[model samples]
Target: MGKWMRSAIQRQKQFYIQQLMQSGLVNDHERLEQWTMAELRREYERFNPAYNAEGGSRHGQTSPRTGEAHH
Candidate 1:
């Protein structure tokens, strides 16, 4: 029970951190460099919510849907 509770709390914290990252609360190279591996993982998870880094599915792709690539 204790383990489960701890896990739940950790999950909740991760969720909020992901939300912040997705919302652009944390941006720029400096901020990225300051984050720990776990925090970066959570941020990446949020950015790539569908876990698809490749140009495959419609989801998880951060680029614009339009074919034109921004400079």
Candidate 2:
């Protein structure tokens, strides 16, 4: 793969690991060893409020004066 592609892949892996840690899936060495990328992604998406459209109401709601949402 190209350098940029490799870098992106590495960054994505790092992001997944961080998300897994935050989700309380991989607590330590043993859990980390047993965790899979698919499982991590699923859990992260499940717990992520941004993934739910209803949960995004705060972002979509606009300020009357500014006529803009926080995004």
Candidate 3:
């Protein structure tokens, strides 16, 4: 029950974040400010297990690197 709900919410958040990223509203995305862009990325990392500043999984760590020992 809780797991399913969380999964749905995570999916929705991922979709919205993707849309924002692809919207091109942020000029010079490569150099986005730490506050705005970084915060958003942090929120994303909360629900995305495989996210990283450089993208994708790294050393089997969680997106937030919570040290939970992801498989």
Candidate 4:
């Protein structure tokens, strides 16, 4: 996930979103610096609650990701 997720799309939009991010169309450069796979998984959860980052939940908001890293 990114720091400021100003926008979120459905899972079907993943491909287009990635293309936009990589092409600078998303405009979240700062987020890229501190981005992590774990965070990405969390964002995925917002789309699919059953989604798991590490085979389990990070307790919704207790993870370090809930700090200033959020948008």
lDDT of 2 by residue, 19-48 (tens): 757766455634544555565555455446
Q: lDDT (CA) for every model shown?
A: 0.51, 0.56, 0.48, 0.44
Q: Best to worst by lDDT, what's the order?
A: 2, 1, 3, 4
Most lDDT-accurate candidate: 2
Candidate achieving the largest TM-score: 2
Candidates in order: C-alpha RMSD to true structure: 9.6, 12.6, 13.3, 11.6
Clashes of each: 0, 0, 0, 2
Per-residue alpha-carbon lDDT of model 3 for 1-71, expressed as tens digits? 69999898666655545644564433343333233445556545544544544565444544342335443
- Model 2 CA lDDT for position 8: 85
C-alpha RMSD in Å of predicted model 1 compared with the true structure: 9.6
Sequence-dependent TM-score of model 2: 0.49
Off by over 4 Å in 1: 28-71
Q: Which ten residues in a row have the lowest lDDT in candidate 3?
A: 26-35
lDDT value, candidate 1, whole model: 0.51
lDDT of 1 at 43: 46
Using all chains and alpha carbons, the TM-scores for the candidates as numbered come to: 0.37, 0.49, 0.35, 0.28
lDDT of 4 at 31: 57
Give the range where candidate 4 is weakest over 10 consecutive residues by summed lDDT.
Answer: 62-71
